[model samples]
Target: MIPIRAYVAADFAGVAELWRAVFPDDPPYSRAEVAIPAKLAVQPQYLLIATDGERVVGTASGGYDGTRGWLYAVAVAASHRRQGLGARLVQAVEARLAAAGCGKINLQVRAGNADVTGFYESLGYCVEPRVSMGKRLGVNAGGTGTSGP
Candidate 1:
């Protein structure tokens, strides 16, 4: 079994590379090195990584907004998929959130990504009757400051 542990500053590059491999279509924020450290400064414990020896194989980022817990950027290297690493990452983050007094956890998967949706479903996540929305507060890697659902 791979070992899952709290993310350290040195793990950023490895994690970012893994994210790019697993989420080629991810938004710019997902690959932002600056934003990542900013998040780590807030709740470092919520960011977790799984490694094989010295190599990072998976990652999961989580947060608590007092009322609820949120999970994002849960990714496993393509070469490491189907080996339960993703589930382990989720479990690790869930434990962290739960210990932080969060009562419920929420996550979002892009619509039409059935494979991803099914993966989460297999891990006990269910689709909610709600629409996912977002607002871009500033320019992203694409250099556009648009906001919408």
Candidate 2:
């Protein structure tokens, strides 16, 4: 099994590349330069990466608000998909959140991302009756997200 472990300083570049390929539609604020430092300032340990020795092929990060856990930035390289790496990345984050006293976990997938819905369902995630809404605050307000790469 490929090792799933906490993120390290060296993972930034590898992760940036992995996400760029895996999630081409990701918003700017969620870019590596912004997200990495922001995550490191928070519960950094929840950021997990799947590595084959020196290459980062998968990534997932979680957050525990003391009640419900949040999952974000889950991605696996195109070549690594269908090999159980995505599920493993998510499971690793779930394990960490559970250890932190999180009773339930929540994640968001953009509307119409049906392709991945089945994958999450297989992992026991079910759709709930709630309409998701959000408002950008702070630096994300203008949608610039962050400065250039």
Candidate 3:
């Protein structure tokens, strides 16, 4: 059986590898880039991972802005997909957010990715039919740069 736990500093490599496997369009995030920064920026209580021993098979990150929490970065390993790993990761993240007193959990999957949106919907996320627009400001949240493989 797979197990869920808090993300450790060393688990970044596995997380990055999983990210690479799941998102083929974009380059994978380097462990060195997302590990320490995510550990420092992401709340320890919100970063949940699923593993078989030291290998991270799945991961999900939750972010809270006091009122609501954004559940993002949910990914499962190539070999581990369709084994409920994705749903488990989401449930774990949701539990953590609920424990932290978050009123609502929000997530946005691409419209073109009907499969992904359906998965989220099956897990109780409703369609937020609104114009979700964005702009690149600089580095950090605004940068046009994406996580490299």
Give lDDT: candidate 2, residue 63.
96
lDDT of 1 at 127: 92
Q: For residues 1-149, what per-residue lDDT tens digits would candidate 2 score against the true structure?
A: 88899999999999999989987877788889889999999999999999988999999999998979999999988878899999999999999999888989999877788978888999999999898877666867674534322
Q: Please, what is the whole-model Cα lDDT of each candidate in the order they appear?
A: 0.83, 0.89, 0.76
Which pairs of residues collide in model 3? 28-148, 28-149
* Candidate closest to the true structure, highest TM-score: 2
Mark the regions of model 2 whose C-alpha exceeds 4 Å error after superposition: 143-149
- Candidate 3 per-residue lDDT, tens place, 1-149, comes to 79988888788788777777775565223243654475557577778889988888888888888988988778888788888989999998888888888989988776588988888989988987677775433354433455332
- Local error of candidate 2 at residue 55 (angstroms): 1.1
Error of 2 at 112 (Å): 1.3
Per-residue lDDT of candidate 1, residues 4-82 (tens digit): 9998878888988887788776655656475587787888789899998888999999999999999988988888899
Name the candidate, 2 or 3, with the larger lDDT value.
Answer: 2
Ranking by TM-score: 2, 1, 3
Q: Going through the candidates in order, what is the number of backbone clashes in each? A: 0, 0, 2
> Could you give the candidate ranking by lDDT, starting with the highest?
2, 1, 3
